[model samples]
Target: MLTSLEFRLLATAKAAPELRHRLRDHGHDVRLCATELLTNVIDHLGEGTPVTVRVIGTAAEHGRVRVEVTDPAPDSPPVLRSAAGWEESGRGLALVDALAERWGVDVGPDRKTVWCELVGDGRADGRPVSGAARPTAPARGR
Candidate 1:
C-alpha cells in the first residue's frame, strides 16, 4: 500500500506501528526501514517537507518487501558515514543498510526517493516493485 505522510518527528514515530500493522507478517524489518527513511528526511531535509512512502511486495531477492520514501530535496541525498564512538548521531542509514536486503536513491529535478528492501516471505497487498540489492556494499554517501 502507498501512504504519504508529512515529515515530522511525531509522525515518523506514529508511522512505525501503523506500518508494522499494515505489513503484518513482514512488518518488523519493513517498519525499521520506514522509520530510518523518515528520520533521515526530518534530520537532513528539514521537517514538514511533503514525504511519500510506499510499501510493496515483490519477488525479487527471493521474495522481499520494499519501502520507498520520497522527499522534495533532491540535493540532500542519504549518505553512509562512519560514526565515531563519541558521536551520538549519524547511524540511521547504517541500520538501514544492515536490515534491508537492498537500497538506493532515485533523484529528480525537484525531489528524490530513498528506498530499501528487506527479505520477506509473508503476504502483502501491493504491486511488485524493484530495487538494487547492496547486501555487501558499503553505504555510498551521495
Candidate 2:
C-alpha cells in the first residue's frame, strides 16, 4: 500500500505515536521501522516522490513480518558495510543491518528497492496469514 508523507520530520516523527495507538502497541515497532526506511527514502532522494510500502504478516516458522519500501533511485543500493573508522556519516544501512533479522536490496538499472524483515511472534509456527482468519501451511518445512 502507499501513503503520503511530506518528507519532513513534522510529519514523520509525529506519526509514530498516533499509529502506535491504533495498532495496540504491537505495530509500534513496525511503524518506526517504516518511518526510518521511508525517512531515508525521502531525505536521500528527490523530493515529493511517491513511496510504496508493503507490509505482510506471515506465520512461517511461526511467521515473519516483512516491510518493503520502494522508491526511485539509481545512485547506490544500500549495503551493510561498515563506515571506515574515521567517517562521521553513512551509518544508516549499518544500523539497519544491525536491527533487521534480514535485509537486502532489489536493484535494476532503473530503481532500487531496499527491504528488511523482522522476526515476529507469529513466525514461530510457520504459517502465512490468509484472508481474515485462515492460515496457510509453509511452502517448505524449516
Query: Cα miss at 106, model 2 (Å)?
Result: 0.8
Each candidate's clash count: 0, 17
Q: For candidate 1, write residues 1-142 as lDDT tens digits.
A: 2222222223355565665565554456676788778888878866566687766554544575567788888888789988998998899899999887778998889988898867763334443443333232232333
Q: Which candidate is the best by lDDT?
A: 1
- What ranges in model 1 sit over 4 Å off? 1-25, 59-62, 122-142
**1-142 per-residue lDDT for model 2 (tens digits):** 2112221222244444543343332344455565567666655774555666555565344346655667767565554557798997566666666656877767668776676666663222333433333332222211
RMSD of 1: 7.1
Q: Which ten residues in a row have the lowest lDDT in candidate 2?
A: 1-10
> For candidate 2, what is the lDDT?
0.53
